[model samples]
Target: MPSPAAPPPPVVTPFTGQFGLAYPIICAPMFLVSSASLVIRAGNAGGMGAFPALNYRPLERIREAIRQIREESAAPFAINIIMQKSNRDRYRHLELALEEEIPLIITSLGHPGEAIRLAHQGKCRVYCDVVGLDHARKVADLGADGLVAVSYGAGGHAGTLTPFALIPLLARHFPLPVVAAGGIVDGAGLAAALCLGASAAYMGTRFIASCEAEVTSTYKAAVVAAGCHDIVNTDRVDGYPGNFIRTPALDALGLEPSLVERILSGSRTARRSLARIRATRVLFGAGSSRATYKTVFSAGQCAGLIDDIPSVQQIIEETIRHYHAIKGTLP
Candidate 1:
């Protein structure tokens, strides 16, 4: 009779067990928006946070950031690395991660064989960003610790499949934990993700509007103001389809790949070169912060769901509370 034994807590995800997370949520890494400050805040708040290594230059900064996170919080966090050959810093970043013995490494855009191997040696885990079943199969065979199913509504390099379609597919086909990433911005989305067989929800765009995000105020405001219709996919950013909030600058660049882009994309090397070219022009050309805000603001359809710029702690607390509320209502 002792308070009915408190009704035993509902199981959130296998992800929590894998990493000792208090909640099954990941603040997905955003290229320029994610910062060490964000990671620290999210980690201390009981959710895992990740930042791209590309966000830091001089390479040593990656080492410093990892150490800083460890000093500030005991919670788990991850470093995201673009593993393609085009990323000259990929190998060095991977070495840094291994040397630091970071808790997690998230690989995107290439094979994760080496990452998985090295991470295992260091007692760390590797999660690969996979958009399809074929790619998922490859990484699973390579001994990936988990899979991040990047669906069509995802902010950055999005996939063609919806969360409903991709999450179940990956969950059914692989024994590895599946984390759903897309237009997931709130507790309801988190609940739905778990119901769809995902072990956790990988949320990116929603965190861009957080108080800890280092992005420009203009960018954060844009995300709060935009909606699902305001989001569009364009291949001009990295020669890969990425979701971004529509702005006059983006519209001027058009959504389709140019004839040269199409023609040169016949080989992997050519595609990488073209991606660098376009990224330089569109992503890096805006020299001033204000100019960049007007040009390229990456966001997902989830922008519609995020109306406030709350602190990272508040966001995590609310999401979990709401998740429990929703779970309780289910028969």
Candidate 2:
């Protein structure tokens, strides 16, 4: 129960390499959870905070979120979009980002071409999340300004690539800015990410447990209690391979590991099997595992390293201290 150690390095990631934010940190955009307050707080604290556009209710709610963030903070922030889920209103979201001249926008779960076009014309940067070199290359060619490399431990539709391997590979040939995501918790990890040739560190679990984040107390506690091993990357919940803490609710369901693997791999039966499980038995499956719905809780492997629920400012201060300590040791 000792407090987490002081940060071990001093880092000043260049702001203009990709994201125009002061520090090379981007809060991962959580669907249904990221709020204007949280995003503004992170941006004001010198990191980029993101809210997925899908979280908005009325189309006007999206503009209100953007307006509020701009009113409260001067630092850069981003809006995340589930490109695959974008409907007729996608243009509306992009239109507002353009009219407001937002700093950054990241597109996930789909293509970034149209959004990227809008972002570029408005002088804003467009970022896309990719699981591997192929997708990484595709996004870059789409004229996306950069990529959020979603490797192992990332919350949604994640891939099992090690940062050591993936970062280096993407850094080598991707030809665009790269934000390394997954397993990034404290300053040490952030410092390591920069060392791995990333321009920034995109974090989800760290923000999910924040005081300002719009997560349920039960979900936040689950994050504080989980370690790297606690999260299960499964297809039982959503069709994607997301990470979450293994709860008794999930365990009560007598699903096998092979089935979970098949679905996570995008096997055709994955979606159908999950639908049947949700419809047939109530208690057999845990919270939100049906094909139509998703589990309320999604955690990152970083949960293991984070034990305390610190404020946004506290985290930034501690991270800055670590950035310095690591810099002090460098030649």
Candidate 3:
């Protein structure tokens, strides 16, 4: 008998064309989780993969990671840089990103004009993460190529507004492509984001459960076991709101740092450094003694959708397949 016809591909928008990707999906540059191997695999799967610049220490290692990704896959990838003044290595990493001529730069935490300018000079695209309409407008005015609407239920450093609200707000105000983030773990969420006016979906928490992610099996277990309600928003991590699985380590944090405590921590650099150390120990180190996992795991509300650990290729392919299935049923 003749072979049955293959299913039609997911709808391709300008985002897919601009980034040379088969799907309008971008792997979020999640710190610690977004490893070089993960990025390479995502790119090979016809999606734009990304890794946080701070994931590599000594700065030079970032360039090496970028080179490794380039050598492994011809597909485009992105590098994320925290634009806060407290990030002492921000400028150094930016320099390396420009020198390497990275394809995309994802900026978060603060204004990204300098990074945008440098990325533009290297003929690279800049996508800034914004939680609100005001921030979106500012980044657009600063010449950002795109905006990542990091809405409520995101894993780390999340915003208050839901994707439904933030995506439309930014899309209406700016002509740049809008990438929806937060609580997008499966194909249905991806399709919903597109329907809400996002050109692409930027997923982080779901990718954490992928095999290629540089995380412990324990971390993956926590993610797999979690649901939307299990995720908690706490500002004790780094003065910004972040979603994390509530564990003994998190409870021990007591409460958010007071203004006096923040001031007493010293200057901006000192406070940032101290916060980084504390965060590293609590989240990545052994602090959560009571739970099955000992790390402070971060996950989006979409954790409910993550039932098993899968390969990056599997995740992307399944997401696209489900997306098409959902689209076919739509009017």
Candidate 4:
């Protein structure tokens, strides 16, 4: 008998068909930085861009901002509902997204029961940022459409799991989409995420310094200037450990290694130890990179990967090209 016909190749559908994207890149909902304009721009570029809802604490502004995004872009956008108990007030912000019928919602700092329920009601998609395999399981079980696997060296209050370890574990257990976040800055970085089985890549620090971002020029300059070893993975006082560039702020606190250990161990709350995080923001509003200097500015160790300050569009294009180039290497 003739050899059996070779089995037809499995279909390779574009990832965007499900997520509704032109690209698999996402602009991370950075705290105090992601603007409605910026969010829409990313979406228009064939990807998702997000804003932290807390930035619009005032209900009226929140509604207005949501309306602006709806009016300005038909592309999909997201709002970040912080997952911290301390940010209970942010729940009201979550209500704004639901009320406006936002399409994409990213839950961070906590469980997604509320976000998932709200999104399902609106026929929206929900994603969550997680630090490890356990949180990944929780996000998936809670009915998120996707999980942003935040691994070691992620900016801000992030987790310690390595991307190599976290991605495969999630790929094996979760059927939903996985977006890798952590120390990813270039096109090569984007390629690696896809190769590792992530459906997308979420970025923050690189965009934080962009002209489209709301932070000061001085802060943007600092991001361009810093090198990798300058960063510190500190848990000195924040309830969760996060990465930041070491600066005078950390040194001035005079924290002993033992004290750092206590905070990281969860025996002591950062509320008592690092009471200055809030006060220091006063400096941020005042445009003093000085206070944030020698102090931890929430940045990933990938600072080494970033050099010149580029527009968000430029970063997106460069990364997209690299993603495709890497795909070409797969065969």
- Please report, in order, the local distance difference test score of every candidate based on alpha carbons: 0.84, 0.74, 0.82, 0.72
TM-score of 4: 0.84
lDDT of 2 at 233: 84
User: Which tens-of-lDDT digit does each residue in 1-331 have in candidate 2?
Assistant: 9997543333455434445555777778887668998888887777778887767767788888888888999878888766653244566777777777777788876667888877887778888888888998888888877878888877755778988888878889966678889988777888888888888888788877888877778888888999789888865555456776888765654336565555554866665565445433322334544432134477888888888788775677677677767767977
Per TM-score, what order, best first? 1, 3, 2, 4
Better of 1 and 3 by TM-score: 1
lDDT over C-alpha atoms for residue 35 of model 2: 91
Residue pairs with clashing backbones, model 3 = none
Q: Tell me, by TM-score, which candidate is best.
A: 1
For model 2, the run of ten residues with the poorest summed lDDT: 278-287
Where does the lowest 10-residue lDDT sum fall in candidate 3?
Answer: 285-294
Off by over 4 Å in 4: 1-15, 255-296, 329-331
- Model 1: what TM-score? 0.90
Quote the lDDT for 76 in model 2: 80
Best by lDDT: 1
Candidates 2 and 3 compared: the better one by TM-score is 3
